[model samples]
Target chain A: MGEFELIRQYFMPLARLHGSSSVIVGPGDDCAVQRVPPGSDLVFSIDTLVEGVHFPVGYRPDYLGWRTLAVAASDLAAMGAEPSCFTLALTLPEADELWLRDFSLGLGNAAESFGLTLAGGDTTRGPLTLSVQVHGVVEQGGAIRRSGARAGDLVVVSGSLGDAGAALDYLPAQEDLDADDSAAADKQFVLERYHHPQPRLDLGKALRQFATAAIDVSDGLLADLNHILEASNVGASIELARIPVSPALVRLKGSAATDYALHSGDDYELCATISEASWVGAPAWLKQQLTVVGEIEPVSGLRLDGSAVVSGSEATGFDHFRRKA
Target chain B: MGEFELIRQYFMPLARLHGSSSVIVGPGDDCAVQRVPPGSDLVFSIDTLVEGVHFPVGYRPDYLGWRTLAVAASDLAAMGAEPSCFTLALTLPEADELWLRDFSLGLGNAAESFGLTLAGGDTTRGPLTLSVQVHGVVEQGGAIRRSGARAGDLVVVSGSLGDAGAALDYLPAQEDLDADDSAAADKQFVLERYHHPQPRLDLGKALRQFATAAIDVSDGLLADLNHILEASNVGASIELARIPVSPALVRLKGSAATDYALHSGDDYELCATISEASWVGAPAWLKQQLTVVGEIEPVSGLRLDGSAVVSGSEATGFDHFRRKA
Candidate 1:
């Protein structure tokens, strides 16, 4: 099929969506249209996913498509902006028809799931890399930034942390697993978490109402939340015991892949702060959907139940520069 | 260096630009804010450059940085939109401080050169890939889209064509070229064409006031303009003698690689159409800046000096998917 038809068929149907009203024009032109609310601000974020580094070396096209968009969307989720349009820049070694078909299906599904439209993007020659720049809107000066956390705020999380990291560890890349160990048994949870972690848009919008500070846990809770703490000049105390460790997580706890839980990263869940006073009035859904794992304090350094964590020591999160080729 | 600090140090300064009145928020959030002019629309486009695909394997980081953003800005120019804000999604194998320092310098240089601000972006682990999403504003629905050309429109181009593709043929992908080859000596032109293309934003704005259709010479003069003819359902006739060929390009004609210049692609200049009646009255700068390349006709297909130009046949321009990995 022709390039124009291919995009129209697979991506256009994904436009005219929830984040579309402000987008006066969506795709099919030199550019897409998005109107800033009369007095509101615009928030922008971009994310890139390389095939082998960001995902399993042999991951399927479908999951690659979903994970790519999901990761970028989560950035918009971190800021309290209404998810709008996104541009996708895809580079691939070659255009395998089957891979394109499956990838488009997964991309279409995720786009439908998030109510986001494909605005525009470029398809180019290169190692497979997916880059998405997400656009969202915040009412005039209403965005919750990393700098807004106060000393006495409660650090909250939307959903359990480290599920994606667990999923990654649980996925086959765990070479340390006994050669004879049965991977089939652990594949389901890991696959779901790895492939389709939702971009909490609804929860993100909710956070604008309750969150004073927020960030998406892309580089692990400790590292990403540390961003907020640093931006706000505050420290955080996590009840290592209370940081929601799911039953799925318990399976990995014995694995010291606890590093996976502690910092293997890529959860894409929101980590936020609300004043201890405001936490009292947080919506019932906020409590049900998000876990209160820590509290913001006036001190400087991360701690687990009052003990120093990573104090003048090595970090336990993704290191873009340190990874071995 | 800390990831957050590195970003704040190099990136925050780029966003310090005071953009158009439509920019409610410039950068530093999840997205950017742009005011759609009363009756105007938001024009969007994205472009990606991969380490080895768009450039040589060991191409300079600084030039890549500048070129990446400049090429994407050309899309806005193609639509007759004023340059606005842009978001970057930079994927690198490693974040070497020196590499990033030069990269940011080039990025900052381009932002300043183009009067755009770097708003927000994602940095992730991957084979090197750079994605830029540029947003521009067209006067309330005045964008000159590819589908707007019609029979009897005067086809035009903003600058001399083929220099880029010709330059590409002679560009040294490895070490410096030998002075013995005349074509190789032309590497300077090709490198400039490839690494430092002008986005034509001013010419684009002028065309919006005088043209009926527009497109960037990304694919090739013949092929890209064909996209306009095909989309507008009109044919075009060109005086082959009138097709603008730069000094460097004239030397390369008649060689097999001439086809590459005619069809090799990656020149991000503007090719547009003006109605025959509006053609003579076109704004002064547009008349000064662009050349009449051809004229549109009631029939379908393209002609050069009354002979049909071979299009949609063999290789016309760069096709990411069709290329060998």
Candidate 2:
């Protein structure tokens, strides 16, 4: 199919089903026009995922589509903004009808899940790469920034970490797992975490009233938290035992689970700093999903269990260029 | 350099220099936050350019930087929106410092020239590709849509066409042109048109109150105008001799200039349909940049000098997938 046919067959339905009323003009135009509600600030972010570099080559199209949008939407979650709309610029080697259908299905499902409208996009021929730019809105002056962490703030994270990182080990043999086998369930759990990690949008919205600083833990906990420290001119001391990990991760990696939680990336969980009083007063349901793993300090470095860890050093998370070379 | 350091050394300065006051938070944040003024609608579009596909391999990075942003921003212009801010997602095989510096310099110059602020972005490792998503603002309910053209509306286009497309013939030997040669200056002119095609922002803004519909000519005048016709459910009759062609293009292609003017892409000029009264009353400066090429009709297909030209059949413009393979 041609680019226009592909868009009409696969993406137009997705847009019609999940498109928001705020979208004045959706897909079939030079640009998508949207109405940002009064008293709101617009939040914008762009992320690119390339085959082999960001994901395994020939990865499942549905999962790839879901993961791509989920990854980009995490930035909006980090800013405590409500899900709004997104544009996708896709470069593919060919126009495979089946791939487009499955990918659009996955993307549409995720859009429905996140309440994001499909605004506009471009499709071109090239080596496979997907660039998604997400737009969201928060009440004016209500955005949480990385530069707001104060000394004595509690460093917190949503849900559990490390499962997605640990899942990398089983990815190559993922298709080999038998559904009826005893260990298959745990493997499937981690695989799901890797392929469909949910953005902590709800947790972030709750933290808007309480959190001092926030970031999504895409580059592992240590590295992403250090960003907040550097931006806010503060330090952090993380208790190694307090870091949370899933049962599936522990079952797969055993003693290495803690290491994964500390240094591996792509969890998509929100890492935030909040004052003790605010954390204590936060809703019971909100506190149930969070774990206080560290505390901000006056000094300007990162520490684990009272031992200093240099920023951007050995324990720092994924750097696309450095890690590759 | 690693991705973070690369961003800091190159892109951060661009953000600081062209950063808009509306941008509450710029680069380094998970998502850039910006305040939209009350009573305005947001307009968005995304475009991707891939090395060896969209442009030749080893293309100049500075021109690539400027062209990428300009191509995306043309959508905003077509929507008659004021320039605002944009996010870039860049994928490269390696981190070349000199390329980054020159590319950022060119990008910064374009940002300053177009009144766009650098917001946030992502850098990843892959085959070289750049995706730009631009955001602009228009008065509430003021965006001109492609579906609004009336049967009597005059088909108008801004500036000349086909110089950029014809420039491709001289691209491989672009560096061989000597200043003292007689034909060198004309070759250089078309090359410049190819490298730095301006988005008709001023003309588009003025078109808001007068135009019934508008689109930017990225995929040949016939193909793009066909889009407006299809959306508006109307037909058009063009005067073959009235199509505009640049002097530089005419000098190079002579008798073939009209074909390039009608069917070439990447000129990035605005095409709109307006009532005859509005066309007559338009400001002289605006009128000077535009030419009356045709008129919309109640029929359902395009015609050239009363001869039928089937839409999406023979005269259709560039299709990335279809044209490639």
Candidate 3:
């Protein structure tokens, strides 16, 4: 089948079930038209994942589809924006029906899970790559930002860290975890965490009410949290004991678990700051999701366990072009 | 410098100038937050230009950047939407400062020309590729669509067609064009047409009031007009003599100018259908921009000068995957 025909048969049907009131026009148009909610500011972000660079070359098409949306949507979570619609630009080496079908299914599932409508996109032929641009809405001037943190604010993170980073070791093995091994279950847990990161949309929404500053942890805790400090013009003192390290990470890295949590990337957890008063007023569910990892300070540099987290190899996160650094 | 630093130094400067009231939060945050004008619908589209596939592998970075945004913005023009903001997902093999600077300058020029703001985007490492997602705004329920053409509607096009397509042959010999040669000047004009297409945004917005249906002629005139026929479930009788072929194309292709105008792709002109009453009432300047190419008919297929434009090879435009077909 031709490129347009394939998209019509596989991708167009995926746009059918997800109905949003804001959408005026969906697929099969030069551009998709939708209304931004009244009294809201539309938030948009774009991310690209190239095969062999971002993910495994022959990774599961369904998983890649889900991950592509989830990773991009994590930025919306960071901005505390409500999911609205998204466009997907898929470039493939060839038109493989089976691969396209699986990828479309996963894309549909991600859109449904995130409450995002498939507005419009383009399908082209090239090296396998996916670029997704997500649009969401937040109340005007209400988006959580990295520049809002202040001294005396508590830094908190949702869920555990290090699990996704640790999963890198087992991702290539894919469905080949030895069922008899003692760490198989833990390996599976981390692998799933790495492959299908659940963007903390609900938590992000709740934080918009009280969080002082927010950033999603995609490039490890130290790297991402540093962004907040740099933007907010404040230093931070992170308590080593407070960093959340998953059991899976401990199983994989043991004494090196802290390294994975602090230095490895692709962990889609929210690292945010909350004033002490706001933390006290937070609901039980939100409190349960958040774990205090650090405190904002008046100084101008980051500290880990009261010692400076020196820059260079020790502190830098994922730098795509400067890989050797 | 790392990717982040490169973006901060180069792209961030481009983001500083285009201040729009619609922007609540711009490029620095996880997402760019903007407000669509009160009574308007948001229209968005994405396009990717891959190395060696869409353009020559080592084409001028400035031209690449400009063409990228122009191609994406053409979709907005086709939808009769006003430019708002755009996010760029740029993947590269390395962090080359000179290339990025020139590219960002071209991007800034395009955004400024189109009255668009640079929002949030991701920069990553991979094969050189660019994915641009443009967001525009149109009055709610006012967007032009291909499906809206009626049997008695007149088919019209904005600007001349096929110059860009015809320029493809001379693109490789760009620097060798002799200034003294008449054909060389024509070649230069078509080459500029190919490299820096001016997306007809103003013309599109003007047509929203009168045009029943619209599409950008990206994949040749005959091919794109066929899309209108398919979507409106109507047929068309196009006058070969009426097809707007540029003087440059006629100079280059001679007798085959008609073929280039009909069969070649990347024209980026708007093909719109207008009611007879609306056509009569259209402003003088708009009338000057638009040319009568055909008339929509009650039947369900396309005709060229009283002969059927056969399906398959004779009718098909550029298909990404089935390039040879």
TM-score of each: 0.90, 0.98, 0.97
> What DockQ, on C-alphas, does every prediction get?
0.54, 0.77, 0.72
Q: lDDT (0-100) at residue B45 of candidate 1?
A: 81
Candidate 3 residue pairs in backbone clash = none
Give lDDT: candidate 3, residue A80.
93
Per-candidate interface C-alpha RMSD? 3.0, 1.6, 2.1
lDDT of 3 by residue, A1-325 (tens): 7888788888886676665546778888888888888898888889899888889889999999899999999999998999888889999999999999999988889888988888888988888889999888899889999999999999999999988888888887867889999899999998999889999999998899999899999888888888888889998999988898887778778989988888766779999999999999989999999899889999978898889976432256687776531
lDDT score at residue B28, model 3, on the 0-100 scale: 75
Q: Write the per-residue lDDT of candidate 1 for residues A139-235, one digit (tens) a residue.
A: 7678778889988889888776666776764567543445565554454555577678888888888888888988887778777777787778888
Per-model C-alpha lDDT, please? 0.73, 0.88, 0.87
Q: What would the per-residue lDDT of candidate 3 be over residues B1-325, giving only the tens digit for each residue?
A: 7777789888886666566546667787788888888888888899998888889878999998899999999999999999888889999988899999999989889988998888778898888889998888888889999899998999998888888888888888897888888788899889999999999999999999999999998888878888888888888999999999887788789889988888776768899999999999888989999999899999878888999977432346788776531
- Model 2, B144-208: lDDT tens digits are 89999999999999888888888887888888887788778788988898899899887889899
Write down the lDDT that model 3 would get. Answer: 0.87
Query: What total of clashing residue pairs does each candidate reach?
Result: 13, 0, 0
* Candidate 3 Cα errors over 4 Å, as ranges: A311-315, B311-314
When 2 and 3 are scored with lDDT, the better candidate is 2
| TM-score (0 to 1) of chain B for each candidate | 0.90, 0.96, 0.96
User: What would the per-residue lDDT of candidate 2 be over residues A83-200, giving only the tens digit for each residue?
Assistant: 8888899999999999999999889889888888888999999999999988889999998999999999999998889888878878888889987787788889988988997998
